[model samples]
Target: MLYYFSLCNILLLYLILISLTFLMLGFYFIMNGIIYFIEYELFMLNGSQVIMTLLFDWMSLIFMGFVLFISSLIIYYSSEYMSGDKYLDRFIILVLMFIFSMMFMIISPNLISILLGWDGLGLVSYCLVIYYQNIKSFNAGMITALSNRVGDSMLLMSIAWMFSYGSWNYFMYIDFFSFNFDVKIIGLLIVISAMTKSAQIPFSPWLPAAMAAPTPVSSLVHSSTLVTAGVYLLIRFNPLYLDSSLSLFMLFISLITMFMSGFCANYEFDLKKIIALSTLSQLGLMMSILSFGYIYLAYFHLLTHALFKALLFMCSGVVIHSFKDCQDIRYLGNLYIQMPLTCICFTISSLCLCGMPFLSGFYSKDLILELYSSCYINMFSYFLYYFSTGLSVSYSIRLIYYLIISDFSFYCYHSIYDEGWIMLKGMFIMVIVSIFGGSMLMWLLFPTPYLVIIPFYLKLMVLLICLFGGWLGYMINKFNLYDIMINLNYNNLCSYFGFMWFMPYITVKISYIYLLMGLKLNKSGDYGWFEMLGGQGLFYMLNDFSLKNQNIQNNIFNLFYIFISFWFILLFLM
Candidate 1:
């Protein structure tokens, strides 16, 4: 047993080393301006070929490197976090499978191979999400799996749709199919598929619900791997969306998702759920940026967000574990005094998330803001972007107040430990990256920086929003204004925000209501009408005839004589 546990750690360490080597190699290639693309046939079907293809430009390499790095850290951290569990080996295996699936998707340019990786991710994530074997975990896993299956089915449809072109490798014909109507159909399907995977708007509940998984899984899958797969797909399929109506549609949906999740996060009480909501919000930001044809900027933000968000989750895991699995922020307070290192990491991550200057998020977020300011967006888009920005700060401040500044509100007596060195060490790696990754990536990824001019007020827009949100969050959380508002005939409004702007209600109406109606129809029509008119009805009528003919069969000899007389009479009449 001990050997198995040690083996898990060893495997993670080996993967980390390999990933670091590849990361450095990728950087070398980038610095020297190299691109590697390869393809080979795996099989032949009806004179067509099934091929394995790889495309490694700066994008895939950097993205692959980041995915591997984060997965390794998560696996390393899980070693200690999951030490006493009976199924530790199983957990490690799942994590490794999830990582492999992500790597496969990253390297593949063939739509077939991408679907292979895509389905693999969805299946493995469901397993990981349901690892706890509780009702909540089971339901969450079902929701997560079913939600992603929507994307999987859409991807399959795209592959079949592409059959008309006689090839499943989208990269080969990306330029040729730019303005084709079929290409638009495929692009629309891809956009919806991405929406499902990224948990945009109507598909968003599964993301937060998936926090029922273990915290390590949350840190890994929710923060880095599963959620980002959609954005990565869009990065690969960027050509399909240029000047397309679907891009504008996606932009609006992404904006709504961004604002909705940010608003939901402020009302969220569960620590892991809050982090999950933040992930959803960041995904929205990525998708929104992608819709604008700034795929590189979106990718840049995706990478940086993965760094700090994973660290943030790891910090949340430490706090939850330390508090004996209590994740309610209302019960969590004075963590800065109790768990100093974890607190420090969490604070830094929160600051980065809020786009504080010079952090990893600062660089990417600053670029996004600059680009938004420079774009020819209408007033609605402008409001949504800046409003979402303020909401991000609002939630960050609200969380900090509840988790760090408030008095410790729990009744249980306990000693807070700065142990869990393994977890903290994993977090430290990301912390260093989160502190400087933005500046480094900005320098590396952008050869020529974007030039955008803005007025003084526009330049300080994010700052002003943050200030306003911080003040509002402080007043609501710290000074009891939320309590006063809740008591004074605003409970219904509070519930709406608390329930994520009625998204859950809307989802139930659309999803569950339809599901129930289908079941009812099946019961009444297929089972009721069809059963009566088809199988059971036929069986009952045949059985009644058989019973009526029982005497005739028993008197076969007499019936034979009667048949002879009838035949004689017929012959005479003829």
Candidate 2:
């Protein structure tokens, strides 16, 4: 175990080194405006070449840097968080594998290589999600894996469709065939793939369900590896189908997803699940903005979001760990007193999530809202965007209230402290980044500012909406007369919204019905009819027949003995 701990430290150092290298390289690429595309031909069939392509741009490199940086911190944190686990080495290796797969996906512009990485993510995530070896973990892993498989299938269909264009490198064709019907289909497929991976709408339940994973895994997966892949893919493919019906469709879906996740987060009690829902909400924001043709904005938000969100998850992990793995927010309170450092980081990240001014999230989130105000979109889209932003603020405040301001609700005997130096060390770097990452990334990603000529009211709308959201969040948690009355009157409605508008029921319940049918089929066919009429039935029949035959033989032998005795008696009489 000591050796594994040392190994984790070594891996963490190496990842940090690599991350720094990538970050520097990304900066260099951005400054020089350079993109390097390297292709290695694997084979040729009938003049059609199959090759592995790598795209090294500022975007990919910067994204990779962030992914590795967070992954390194997560691994370091896990060394402390999972120190007692016997399979620490296995966990470390799985995390490294996940990072490698993410890097693979990040650099690949080719559909085939993307699929390789995409499928790798799904497979490893399932492993990580089910790491705890419980029925809940198993269920969560199943839902997660199956949900991703839907995206995988969509990507596969896109690949098949792209094969008609004679190249798997979608970047080469997206511009020339932007309006082609086949290209449109491919774009649609990619959008659906993105939706599934990002956990939009029907796929939303899996994100929260995946909370069964260890907190460290959740921190990494929810922040970067699993959930962000879809957003990244959309950013890459945005030029192909932007402003079409597909983008409109994506806009609607993402808005709904954003609204749903934010609303659900407000009602959520679990610490990690709330963060997961927030991640979902952010992904929706990213997707929606990307759909509006603000690719750089979406990418910018993705990077900044990754930094703070990872920190947020890590802080939640600390709280959960100190609380003896008690994740229910209702049972947690006054953490600011028990774990000041963790709470500080938690508060910063939470505020960042709420788009608090000057925080990492504020730069990207505020810009997104301002851009939305400037766009010539419909009233529904307009309302949903601002409403979702408010919801985001509302949930962030609600969560902070529950965790920090509320009175301690746990037992008096409980001992909760921030004693994990290594965990704190891991989070320390993130604290710095979460504080200033947004401004840095905003400047780095967008050298020229976007000129927004919006009305004064529209410019102030974001702040006003945020203020309203904060007020609502606090009041909702206050349990005042109005709140109680509303809850009593709208019990079912609250339950519906709290449950992600019954998305879990739609995904889990529907799949559960099918699973039940499968179980019945197994019982009635494999165990029932097959056992009764096939091998087991034949064996039982043969065994029964043999037993009866033995009985008959015994009876015949007894009768013969009787006849012999009678004959012997008759002979004696003669």
Candidate 3:
């Protein structure tokens, strides 16, 4: 019945949405499918409306194009990749579910509807992650699924609070301010969920865990797909951020996530894990810029990052597929000779990622830095811009150096078999864009495309700063000179928060001494405090009550639970 209700709701949502769209959605999907076949780009700035009380904006449509583009690629790419796997039907079903959920998320008519799609994305992705359902992979997938559930819970509660406060006024973007509850409280909840989704700093472990999935799956998640959904959510809630005045808080968190993950990625051995961590860092950089209210720059970087990151992941997948499932970069070497096209594609993407001058990374990254520099009118904001700019360069350069120049000493040092033309063609197109699209974008942003533009040269100068910063990062990794490699002691993190990680050991040791003393005294029980007063006593009383009347116990239990929950909610609000 619940499934049927959800299905009816989803169908009802589509009916309302389809009625609003000028072009037929079915026809549009078919046309996108065909255009996907042609290897041609479409310049479409589409329309949207407030249907079913949800404000569907132009930005939502733009992001939807990205969602469809990547989902189509995943379907296109995985149809071949997962062809011989035994769970082929299951894979296709999960893919369809994922694609459907992504569409719902993009065009969701309400906060609740968007959240439903978010949960669906998490569910289907977890299934696809362990599609083979192997024990180790299943464990990883389950952990990530659990994390998503926690994030979902926070998001659901936040949306409920927002709606309850805003009531009917919650129908559109302008209605957020109509709510009576603390905007700061509401904003924190939204940002918390966003951080977990985007894999920011402390919550960053999930993406690496998600690498338990197939390479194609990882590619989609990294490149403007599900992992990005969180940042996109934050972007969507720009009104909330502006209301809460929490942009500085957001920028700080993003900057920390950016550099820290980058440093960590340097030490990782798994091919997918490295890319996944790099994606986290790069997305963090974009989110940090996004917090500055430069939405266009953030969106542009997202588009640029989508291209090179997906291309890199696809290329990496080919490499891993060849190694008979060995994913350690340490076990991969000198494949430029054997898989020339894949190597070229990977190199181009790596350079693009590094923000090398004249590359796609250069344009997107340079614009963000330009935006950052403009924020230097204020000293605090200037310091933030300075730190984040340095972090971006560090992480970007680290990824390139590890993939291209590091001495990983691959044990399986064999030539790669030539992949099919489908893979090669995708790589070919992506590399061209990675190299030259930066120049085109620079032209779009500046007058005379640089002929009448000294301001543009200043942009070039900022571009030089990024390149030099990346070069410094290359030297840092190339020298092997950091204690960052040996810093994985999680016990240290626990201790840094001033909790002794050895508390359990110390407690057990002291307990043993107490046990020896108690044995000497012939005392049997370790129970005390609440246990001595009403613990077993209360249980026995409950058991006696149950023996007297089971119905009475059930009613009492439900009554107190409801009363306490009501009081707690009141207290929390206060």
Global lDDT of each candidate: 0.86, 0.90, 0.66
- Which regions of candidate 1 fall more than 4 Å away from where they truly are? 521-554, 564-574
The Cα error of candidate 2 at residue 143, in Å, is 0.8
- Which ranking of candidates, highest TM-score first? 1, 2, 3
Residues 51-113, candidate 2: write the lDDT tens digits: 789999999998999999999999989999999998888898899899999999999988989
Query: Candidate 1's residue-wise lDDT over 458-513, tens digit each?
Result: 88887888788788777778777657868798988778877888876676466777
For candidate 2, give the lDDT of residue 165: 81
List the candidates' TM-scores in order: 0.93, 0.89, 0.70
1 against 3, candidate with superior lDDT: 1
Instruction: Return the lDDT, model 2, position 175.
Output: 73
What does candidate 3 score on TM?
Answer: 0.70
